[model samples]
Target chain A: MNIEWLSFLTVTLVTLIGSLSLVALYSFAVRLKAIAEDEVRGAGLAKSGAVVCFVLCGCLVLLGIYLIVPQLGGSGGH
Target chain B: MDLTLIVVLVIALALFFDFTNGFHDTANAMATPIATGAIKPKTAVALAAVLNLVGAFLSTEVATTISGGLINEGDNGFSIGPEIIFAGLMGAVVWNMLTWLLGLPSSSSHALFGGLIGAAIAGAGFSVVNYGTVISKVLLPALLAPLIAGLAAYLCTKLAYWVTKRPSGLSSPKRGGFRVGQVFSSSLVALAHGTNDAQKTMGVITLALVASGLQESGSHVHFWVIAACALAIALGTYVGGWRIIATMGTGLTEVKPAQGFSAEASTAAAILASSHLGFALSTTQVASGSVIGSGLGRKGASVQWRTAGKIATGWLFTLPAAAVVGALAATLTYFGNVGLVLVAVIGFGVVLLIWWLSRKDIIGPHNGVSDVDEAGGAISIPTKKQRRKMRKRQREAERAEAERMARELKKAQKNKKKEANGKTKVPTASGSKSRAQEASAPKREARGTKEKR
Candidate 1:
């Protein structure tokens, strides 16, 4: 059988990066929120940083949704 | 007219299969969130159902080729009729129901493909199947998808825990944040499931229409067909496959909010990425793999390998088992309408029987997880605390049983010594009254002597 090794590799790479980054970003956001709540110094900055991390995570989720729905210019041919 | 009736029956059966597909896979997206208490069971299923309804309207590109190039549908290939499709649907439905009852998260797509392949072969020899496509597309992906998703989830889980780790004295962040993240990630998985799976049924219905000459082969799916399929699936999702949900949520592994979030994110990412790359994988397998990976990633968490093994076994058997059932159903169709009616009767009867059996040990939203304990450790792997409790209970029971046996043994020994000394007599029916009086008289004499002393 002619297995598409290239495609397989691409999927593995993309899934790892995509999922790991998303989880990391969300974790970072949670950490920031905790820091903001626990400490007085730089609380405002930490809270804002948490917001940024959350926005990034949300964007990644949107990107995922974009890839799933074909009408939204996705190549999901399942 | 007869053909029309047959086509109608196939469409109806296809819709029912779609319903099963929805419920069988509800655990794929909702299990983690529910298990972690990120979402209530009823609310989680409701959200999944709604998302699935919306997702069914998202794409129709793949709906035109639901077979995924597994069947030989070219002009020179064997012509597959509506009857064959009917038989295939029956096989898929039966297999799906059986797996759900056993609470194994097998692939609905595999069941569908296996059913079609089996029916096609039974109808027109083995040449009608593309074994290469089966191997490359279905088999290979099945093996790889879980591994990739698991690795991603494992690493992601470690990262989540590391990032969230706190200083020596301060408390860790409330898992409420991770719970919120889980809600979104699980929702995405649900939406993706709806988009991918609902189309398969729509495609089957459209194929039946085209085969019966009611619609053009290249034309778009009918709106009514899409709508009916969407509703059927949504209803099924709302009903929820609580049994499978219990297995996935609590049986395979213990899921905390952090692990739940990581697992869901990995599942959503893997599914979206694979679909975007046109690499088809079973959503059920991906989710289960993620859960297992998260379990391994957590420092103290343990995966229930027995449960995982059961799920893997189900996956291996899904295709061949469904194919056998499909072949049997197709073989019956050779006798024409009488055969069709008979297949229907037998199919419905089996469905009813399964439903009846399920009721004997019902699993619903209220007691889904609680009931898992009795279904076998393969369906409900006890948590560490639960395992400890069970072991303690087992030890206590063993001690109690030992004490009882010791007491019984001592009593038996005492009775044997008495009989050897002739101090105890075996009573005969004729002398029973005299024996009882004699025994009492000795006891009275002993009491009198003790009083005099």
Candidate 2:
């Protein structure tokens, strides 16, 4: 009757982290807007930050794929 | 005399259902992006198709859950065999096609589940269903996932607007950036869709293999099954369900780029989490709920309640209707070899009829979102190609009218010249008649001679 506590923790953590990372990426997009008004260097920095944040989000998706890939190899017993 | 033939038939049917599932739910992931002009319709579907294929290779957990967790397998008294599985799949495929024709975003997962449950019960008994698993894994997730995603999207949308708010009538740089981000977020949703949805077919196919004694019980999804299901769904996605896409993208609410981005992000999060948890969730319901939530989240955004109600009603009917079809198909399958052939023939007929009905109102990429306007029909700008085509047609019509007028004018000029020639002839004839008068003719002749000299 014991729950798979580890799996539960992984799912919850991934969901939270994924959502928060998206929010952070959006915040960077917002910052880029404010920076575009003045200071060209600041805008460039914010633009790069947004790109990095987006890439990080993509990495999270890749992590999701990694977790799911084991099922495809037919090696893991469900 | 052979089970192998039925096994092959079941596998083919499973793949076909997977294909229908792909196109029917393409709107769930790509609708918002296409609606907001963040990506073109063809490009969005193409991207979704490729990602969905990759996503299929990503997860096997859900497949195992479907194949092993739901139905009673082995020589147990309640074990439902491969024939029931085939009937269940037929039920699901029929329902998916019906909903797609109606442009309603009903859950394909629910349809499959209902069909399986129904066919299992009809073929074996009510005891064949794993109620605990159904309630815990399938039912609970179906109810909760959408609300969770909606709430997540609602908050995300509110926060996005608050952070990017600008002076009235001024453009915000955030809009352009979010539009670009939408392509990325929606792609994730598409991938998550592949991870979660394509696995369901693989699971069902594996279950069939087990039931038919082709594979051992509790065996992993076969590589061939995975590849077949993935390729089938990908091809379906490429075809694009424009009807459902229109309903979800524009019918429910007008989606701005920011709203589209948040909704997709929320959908991806919810679906990926559920996929990881091995929950058989409905991405269609989750995406639809998120769209409605985003609509309600935005200030002054109007949700088409009627369209939303139609979708909700479809969701309610999806399970029972599919169950009925599954039961009927199972009953037919019980008739022996002839029954299987009969079921196949009838299933094909019904599918063909649905396709024929759909032809009455075809929705294509070019006009997918034209019916519903986010701006209350204020924005009906045609695409550049459409506009150019319209202009060209208008110019051609104008030129034709001008040419007709010119032709008429030329004909009139010729008629006028003929009348003038007739008048000149009449004058000569009158002069000849006057010459018959001797005195008048002498004066006329004298005038003529003087002029000639």
Candidate 3:
């Protein structure tokens, strides 16, 4: 059997980085939102930071969709 | 004339398989969100249905070669025809329904492949199969996909908790955000499922058309074929396999929103990444693995090893069991038209029987989300025999308890009468003590029996 170990390793690495980063970003955004809600000093800064994190998360989701849909330049072979 | 009819029948069976596939996998994307109360069960199925419908239309590229070259298509080798395809589909559909009734999440793709390989062996010979491809592509991926997804989910869950941990030791206010994120992440999984799974049915139907000389080999799937497959799958998704949902959602582990979000994110990322890299993985296995991973990540959260064991066993059997059914169907089909009709009759009968059996312990949206016990153990719906035995035991216990209570009541009344007499004529201390011991002994025994029950 000709197993593509390289491809499998790449998938594992990509999945780890992609999933962990997205979770971390989303969690950080939630943390910022909580800080802003507390209305402490620099609440405006925290709110802006939360928005940026959310936007980045949204971009990651879009990238995932782009990868899934073949019409959108994704490999799309299941 | 017979060929055309056989091809049409094959298409119909293929569509039915697609329908089963839709329901079988709905749990993969929606179970966690529903379990965590991030989405209502009804709304989650509806959303998944719509996204699946749209995802089916996304691409037909993979549909051209759905088998991924697992079957030998050489000129001298035995060719796969509509009859073989029909038998294979029968096998896949039967296995799919059986697993659904048991509320186990096995791989639909593996079932499809196993059925086809079994049918091919029966119809042609062993040489018709490419064992190398089976081992390399199908078996290897099946073993590895879950482990990779599980690891990813574990790390993602830890990261989510670490970032959201509050100094006050209370649940962070931002935990609600994870619920919102879960909806989107699970949606992506649903959409990807639509793209990946629906295409397999399309490929099967198109292959049938090609074998019947109604379509060209290597040609694009017909628009009607695509639309029909998409609709069948979407309808099935709308119906929702609530039993499997109950198992995946609550049977494996209790999910909080943060954990649900982490699991979904890990599932979606793994699916997209694997597909993008041209490595196929079952959405069901990846999702289940993620749920287990998240369970492991959370402190004090326990995984139901029994339920997990049952699921793993189902996975191990999915291939060979479906193969046996496919082989049997293929053997029957060798008898020609009468055989075909018999296969259809038997298949339809089995479907109805499973549906009938499911009614005794129906799992629906109302109870699907609450199918676990308070202690986070899966509450398996007992089989008919088990239920009957349980009822009998309960009734017997009730009768014994009732008899004990009656005896105690009579003894208490006698004691009261004795006390009345003692008021009139001073009773001996030894007699009172003996009466007290007689009363307490049975009472203690009754309490012991009750505790045992």
How many clashes in each structure? 0, 1, 0
Cα error, residue B57 of model 3, in Å, equals 2.8
What class would a CAPRI assessor give candidate 1's docking?
acceptable
lDDT of 3 by residue, B30-91 (tens): 76677677788888889999989987887664465454356677583327777888888899
- How does model 3 fare in lDDT? 0.75
lDDT of candidate 1 over B1-453, digit per residue (tens): 289889889988998888877866676677667767777887888999998898788766446545335556658432778888889889888887776666565678888878877987897779877777677666787799878988998899899989988875677555569987888988988877777778778877887776666776568888998899889889888876555555553353346788778877887777666655544457777776777777678664445667667667768888889999999999998898898898889998888888887788877432343212211223233465876775676567656655665665565556656665784455433254454455456445645643442
Q: For model 1, give the RMSD to the true fold.
A: 14.6
- Per-residue CA lDDT of candidate 2, range B165-246, in tens? 7665555444666777888888998898898999999999888888877788777889989999899999888886555445
Candidate 2, after superposition: displacement of residue B165 in Å?
A: 2.9
Alpha-carbon deviation at B248 in model 1, angstroms: 12
Tell me how each candidate scores on DockQ against the true complex.
Answer: 0.42, 0.18, 0.47
Rank by DockQ, descending? 3, 1, 2
Candidate 3 to native Cα RMSD, angstroms: 12.3
